[model samples]
Target chain A: MSDADRVKVPRPVARFDDVTRRFDGGLVALDRVSLSVHEGEFVSVVGPSGCGKSTLLSLLAGLTAPDAGRVWRRDARPGEVGMVFQEATLMPWADVRANVMLPLTLLGEPRGACARRADEALARVGLDGFAHARPFELSGGMRMRAAIARALVTRPRLLLLDEPFGALDEMTREAMNDQLLDLWASSGLTCVFVTHSLYEAVYLSTRVVLMSPRPGRIQAEHRVDWPYPRGEAFRADPSFTHLRSALSVRLREDAVTPEGGAGP
Target chain B: MNGASGRAYLRWLAPLALAVAVVVLWEVLVHVFAVPVYRLPAPSAIALALYDGHSTLLESAWHTLSLALIAFVLAVAGGILLAIAFTRSRLVEAALYPYAVVLQVTPVVAIAPLILIWVGLDNAPLAVVILAWVVAFFPVLSNMTLGLRAVDPGLRALFRLYGAGAWQELRLLRLPASLPYLLSAMKVSAGLSLVGVVVAEFVAGAGTSPGLAWRILEAGNRLQTPRMFAALVLLAAIGVALFIALSCLERRVLSRWHESRR
Candidate 1:
């Protein structure tokens, strides 16, 4: 598409308006955080460990309610939004197919349909022939792949991932990132990815959001301004380096600041 | 035999050889010391007694086995259902859990007479089964309760995210997660049930039908030392057999997933 066409705004798939969340000890996790993700967009939220990035995804997934303000989504029904946590979280007792089939199974779908969808999902994540294999038999990356397959099996419109590749080694993580982008591009699913890695944010997202810790709030948003199907060559591009360095510097500034203090 | 088969052969042979050697030594010592048969019967004498009273002894063995097995099945069913109740409601667990512990800590020997009295001496078999169930059910209840609560938080969150209802959560997630704990508890219960049956039979005296324990008591009264030894041997064999069978079932159920099976 031309720049003119790309500049047109799409419909919002999900929105968070002045959302505030607190923990049991009254620690503010996110304060007055607002974000809007557009249809077919890849939005990556980057922050330090305590920046409420995970809590943000939790809100979108409807696993947690915002203590204040409103979180809205176009499709809020069950199976409309898929979530993947940092850990694969596949049931140890179940085989890959059964684990992937869980969402449909819970919805009371027919057994044959559940199995077929589960197998198709497994194949999508390159886990064909691994349907019958136990989760214990998979390697770390393969286990995460199975988790992603499970998340995708529901064919959700909106995908919320909370550092799903964080535990993986650098090489495996990069490969997964590429695979995730491929899935997103092919499926046209809106994605909101949360990660600590600036390189990952820049490489995979259409918009990279940086958050400040100590009651997390959106500090900055950078548009990647790059075309789709970004490959290995894009990583070496000067634009990619510049954006990554900017995010790194911004993150360091936010990290060193004390609670209730301003960054220099 | 090849090396792998040779190792397997040795594994089987070692235990068998030790048992045979012990029996032979006991027989020889009894003969050499001229130990009176009433005090300790020779292995050969015990064997002969077992043969001579095979019909009566086998019938008694079957009675004890069936009683223990029935108690075991009841304990398993009751324990799991109670555990599910405990998981679904905190109030039920808080109210009833202490009593379960009380039942466990109280000795079966102390309560067998009370059970017999309550169940009535006329229904001695039912009382015996009830006593056995009391002894055997606690391990399964406590373990399953813990297992249900010990679910992975992430998995729990995932299930909730998918909007799984309470029954679906139990059926798809909690029940399967608790299988290993349940199986291990079953192993412990299997042995405890047998012990409970023996103790209950002893307390019941001749009021109940003749079980192996009853046979042993009768043999003791008459100074039939070989018969007592023979009954004791059968009881030990049953205990070992029950433990082995439950262990095999555990391996079968858990081999695909559990670390203990590996």
Candidate 2:
């Protein structure tokens, strides 16, 4: 879509307005970062290591507060936000069903209702038969599926994923990417995904936000105009390759040009 | 037999064979050297003593076992409760944890005589149980506190995002996360409790209805060396039995998820 059309987008379901976050020992994790994620938008934040990508997601998830500026969530309600970490983070002692049921259980839902909801969430994530299996009994991808099932069980409006596929093999990562897109599409859930892989950002996101390290700030934003249900054909398309390479070149330039007062 | 089962068989057989060899050699050497029965009795003589005093020995064993079991249950319950309190309030932990460490390092033997006197000879069994509980409480407290605090940061954040209250987090996450640590601590404390009971009985003298340690002391005074050896044998058997039982419990609890079980 043209820039003119982009300006016509509706109100954001979640937004960060000129936000800044600082850690202990005077480290600036983010600096005046403004981003907005509208309902049903698949937005990916891409940055190198130590580039405040996670801090961005953490702020959006309300896991951490910004040092300055405003974090707004439209119609914020209990259990309205779900987060998936880089690791599966499943309770080693709990079975998949119990793990998925945890949010509802904590909310004081009835036992029968929690069980039915957990089973439904498991089925949504294609984990129907593995509800009774322990976390250790699952493969890497399957364990991550269990984690997603857990996050999705609460039926949150917005999902924040922090490099959820980083630990998976390449083939498994691609499969999970496709599955995540399907989940996002069918559920009408807004997603703010963080990753370092430009290819992944380009393949899965409606808009890619590039961040630079050393007091992280948004360096660029690219609108991906690819149609929905993007598949292997999109990966082989010349436009996909051009956009990915252009992002890579911009990232390389940022890496070479060191910011003053930033440590090596 | 297949290799795995053959290896399992050998694991049991080797220890049994070694024990039998040691006993037979002891019996043979006592006979060959003509050692006085007062100094070192033959295995057969000790066995005869055990058979002759079977009723008395069994009674003493039962008394000691009961004291140890009571003390063990109290230690586990008290330790876990204290650990939960510590996790909930940093001020409580800071105020009380040093005293716990001091209690652990003071040596139960040094305090047993004082404990016996304070509790009075009329309540000697209670004194023994108290001493044993003191000895067995520290491992569970320290290990469980560490385990409760060792929750994965991601999981902690998830719990927070889901708005789990303190009690819910403890029941669903902290308590289950700390189980492997608690079970291992229980194993260590089990052995310590048995040791504590025997030492406390020794210090409490014959006032506590003649536990095995008292039987050992009584036999020593009369120069019934075989009976003393029999008492020692029973004590060793009790210790081994407790360890094996605890190990089996640990296996049952941790076999599904714990890395140590694997």
Candidate 3:
């Protein structure tokens, strides 16, 4: 099926109620932060560095529990979760296929099944032929591609991404953004991605959530009413420019806030 | 590059040539000095002595080598057990460890006489040989334990999170990591084992079912200098052979998984 036809199947998803997470010894990392992610939605969370954005993704991935908060997969959707860490974090000693197949291996899935799924995922990330190569052999962008492939191989109901391309060069980052958009659109996966990139947030996201600092809370949300299966043409559009500028202004305001009290 | 390669060749060839040259010189020097055949024997004279007394020399070598082998095994086994107990409980390490240290540091020369006196005759010297084994063992056991315990806490936590039990983690990861340290200890201890065997033999040889040390002394008393040198050469050969064998063993076992092999 063509990419345009793929985005129509899985409708958007949302989470009800707030998420509050507090650490021991009276440190609150998240305070009543609530966000909804519809199926086939490409949402970006743009905020100050310690805005509990990554923590929010971690909670969605079931990696960390939120104190006094409940998370949901939204009714009527078959649920599965995938997470990509900020760093590629591929197993150094293992090759790309082996690294991507780790979760499947851990889950005790047969080697042949994991191999096929891994190959398909690698192809989805445009990394089909680089399967047997070790992580050290790959460049930064390729490593992140492998990490993304690993996350997507499970074909989960929800995809949680935290700055997956933050370490790449500008050229590579833009290319990865297009690829990710294509993947999300075609797979109809709900993605709640955390990023500090204003242009990336505005360009790739269907909805953008700007967050405030310490005991992180949502500051603002913007919806991008653009066509799906976006390409380089969309990146040049006036609407993209306007959204980026507005998001930049809010981020700057949060940054210069003297109290430094709202984020992280 | 030429110099380095030549130097590498010279490292082996030079020593071998020197050995041959020394034998020739000794053979010629005795005739030139008119040194009494008894007082300062020539290389030929020692060869003659060995030929004449071949049975006795070979028998003594067997005795000494067997003693060294047996004592070395006992020392390694007992020391490893003691080390495990010591490492497991800090209080035990603190408690019974003074003796391990005393055993390691105290000169075998001083203790051989006492050990001989306490154990008295029959196998006392063999027991003394085991003292050398004990001396050789602690460094390996201590170093290996340290290496085993030195696994990264991050990896440890990851393995724990993955549900790897203690034995599985140790067998799969900890043991391999600690191997280099253990092999290094074995290299030193292998040489030490030979030294311990000889020293124990030297002190205890005069008393009874003697080893090569007694043969050396008996030959020396009769001014059988070549015989004495022959025995020393045999002992040196044994030590070299043991060292090489152990080094090969260490390399073979570790090369499969370790950086050293790579």
Per-residue error for B39 in candidate 3, Å, reads 18
lDDT of each: 0.92, 0.91, 0.75
- Candidates 1 onward: DockQ, in order: 0.67, 0.75, 0.11
Model 2 clashing residue pairs (backbone): none
- Which regions of candidate 1 deviate over 4 angstroms? A1-7, A259-264, B1-11
Tell me how much of the true interface, by contacts, candidate 1 captures.
Answer: 0.73
Evaluation by lDDT, superior candidate among 2 and 3: 2
Give TM-score values for chain A, per-prediction.
0.95, 0.94, 0.89
Using TM-score as the measure, the top candidate is 2
Residue-wise lDDT of candidate 1 within B1-262, one digit each (tens)? 5987889898889999999999999999999999999999999999999999999999999999999999999999999999999999999999999999999999988988888888788888898899899999999999999999889999999989889999999998999999989999999998888888889999975746589999999999999999999999899999999988988888988888856553
- Candidate 3, which segments miss by more than 4 Å at Cα? A1-16, A74-79, A258-264, B1-262
RMSD of each: 2.9, 2.5, 7.5
Q: Rank the candidates by TM-score, best first.
A: 2, 1, 3
Backbone atom clashes (below 3 Å) for every candidate: 0, 0, 10
State the lDDT of candidate 1 residue by residue for A1-264, as single tens digits: 677776696889899999999977999999999999999999999999889999999998899999999999999988999989999999988899999999999878899999999999999999999999998889999999999999999999999899999899999999999999999999989999999999999999999999988888899999998898998889999999988997899888777766436534
TM-score of 2: 0.96
Q: Higher DockQ: candidate 1 or 2?
A: 2
List the candidates ranked by lDDT, beginning with the highest. 1, 2, 3
